[model samples]
Target chain A: NAGVTQTPKFRILKIGQSMTLQCAQDMNHNYMYWYRQDPGMGLKLIYYSVGAGITDKGEVPNGYNVSRSTTEDFPLRLELAAPSQTSVYFCASRGTGGADTQYFGPGTRLTVL
Target chain B: DQQVKQNSPSLSVQEGRISILNCDYTNSMFDYFLWYKKYPAEGPTFLISISSIKDKNEDGRFTVFLNKSAKHLSLHIVPSQPGDSAVYFCAGGKDTGRRALTFGSGTRLQVQP
Candidate 1:
């Protein structure tokens, strides 16, 4: 089974443009997260969802929004792309139980010009 | 400020040697520490983890040592192999109902065979 899948392996966007990064997991996990990694930097959490219909902001949630419509899908939306938002975006999922290991998807690389 | 820190930007080790990756955190509220490994163009994968109550945890060829008083942790990989070369990230989790992770800037590890 595909544990976690992310769409748009690479993308380029102009300033003020908007796009959505698609993420889906087949593991039926209740916890899903969106994170962005800048060059030579660690991943920073953007937004997270504990379950469908519930979403919350994370450390770096300034220019992004998230929606968890179903147990399988959690998409990240960039309202107004900026140069600072050019980074690799990763999606991860984990079970609801205590300290479950997180499974990550192949990241989406976005370049904002 | 970055709560977690990986001071070394990169490390090089010969095949069959030991590779040690260090991480320190400024937050005492973090009760769990984890290590993730990432290759180019791929998302980070969970490698090993240790709880505050445990001083050390071993998984096959990898070992994680945690020093709660020092707010430091390390990953030791014995007999380092060429395939083990990648960026290693240190992450911490604070269990305040939400298992959110804070990551440090990764340390790139190069193993020469």
Candidate 2:
């Protein structure tokens, strides 16, 4: 299985611009998450989905949105991107079991100027 | 507030030596702790995990120890190899609800051969 995969390995956006970060998992996980890691900072959850059509805000959800329309896909949208949004974004997925191990994608490096 | 913290930004160890990485969490609600390792340009991968009920868990050359009194957890790698060089992240989470993990800033380990 390809496990989890994220599109746009690297991207740079101007202030006020908008874009979507795409994520997909072949494992058919019931949970998917979006997280951003700033330089010298830990990864903070932006949004997550328990299942298709079920999304929730996380630790840092400002300036971002997410939707899980299918069990295999979860996409993150950034409206009016700001410099503060510059960071490495990671996508992860996990099964519904009690185990806390989340499989992560290669991640997308995003820069907003 | 930062729920999870990895105080050391980086660590270096000689080949065949032992490497110990530490993590602390502020929330007592966190019952599950995990460690992830990431290579440059790659996403983080699951290394090991420990539950609150267990004081330690071992897998191959890696071991995780949890000290509930101190609200601390650690990962130990015996006979560290150059191939083990990577950024290690420690995370904590609750077993109930959505089970979202709070991650540390990460510690870059350089295994010198």
Candidate 3:
């Protein structure tokens, strides 16, 4: 079902450059999330959405933004990339009704120069 | 401020032995715990999960145990195989379904033959 798919598996951005990381799921999940994993650290939540048009900030939402225009899509936007933002980004989704586990997409490795 | 932590960065086990991975969480609000396994360059796949209401849940060769009072949980892989070699991540989540999960720094497990 293409559980979750992300675009541009790898990207390199310069300081101050902007980009949007795309995430889509064909599973028809009601919940979608964006997370970043830095070396030697756990995955940190950046943003999430419960449904289309409903998005909220997560633990590390400072340098990112997100929008859930449709149930199938949730995109994360980086306004100004920085070295600290260089990390492996992942997209995940989950269905409702007591499903506690999430399905993850192959991560996008970003490097900011 | 790390809500979840995996004390061990890596562990090596002989094939056909048991592999025990531990995780601890600081947040008392976490009502569910999950374990995921990831291969290099691939996304994480759910292994097992235990709810706060229950202390243990078993799935085939994998089992998850939860200790609510201590805020600790663990995943056990019995008769581990070389194919089980991967990074294991433990995550905590609330039952609300609206909140994103807090993940632990993954433990790289190497099941050597």
Error of 2 at A57 (Å): 0.4
Better of 1 and 3 by lDDT: 1
Ranking of candidates on lDDT, top first: 2, 1, 3
Q: Which candidate, 1 or 3, would have the higher TM-score against the true structure?
A: 1
Highest lDDT: which candidate?
Answer: 2
DockQ of all predictions against the true structure, Cα-based: 0.75, 0.85, 0.82
TM accuracy, model 2: 0.98
If candidate 2 were superposed on the true structure by all CA atoms, what would the RMSD be?
0.9
Q: In model 1, state the lDDT of residue A101.
A: 72
Q: After superposing candidate 2, which stretches have Cα over 4 Å from the reference? A: none
Give the poorly placed runs of model 1, Cα more than 4 Å off: none
| Alpha-carbon TM-score of each model against the true structure | 0.97, 0.98, 0.97
* DockQ, model 3, C-alpha based: 0.82
**Candidate 2 lDDT, B72-97, residue by residue in tens:** 89999998999999999999877677
Candidate 3, clashing residue pairs? none
Assess the local accuracy of residue A11 in candidate 3 as a C-alpha lDDT between 0 and 100.
Answer: 98
True contacts kept of each: 0.67, 0.76, 0.80
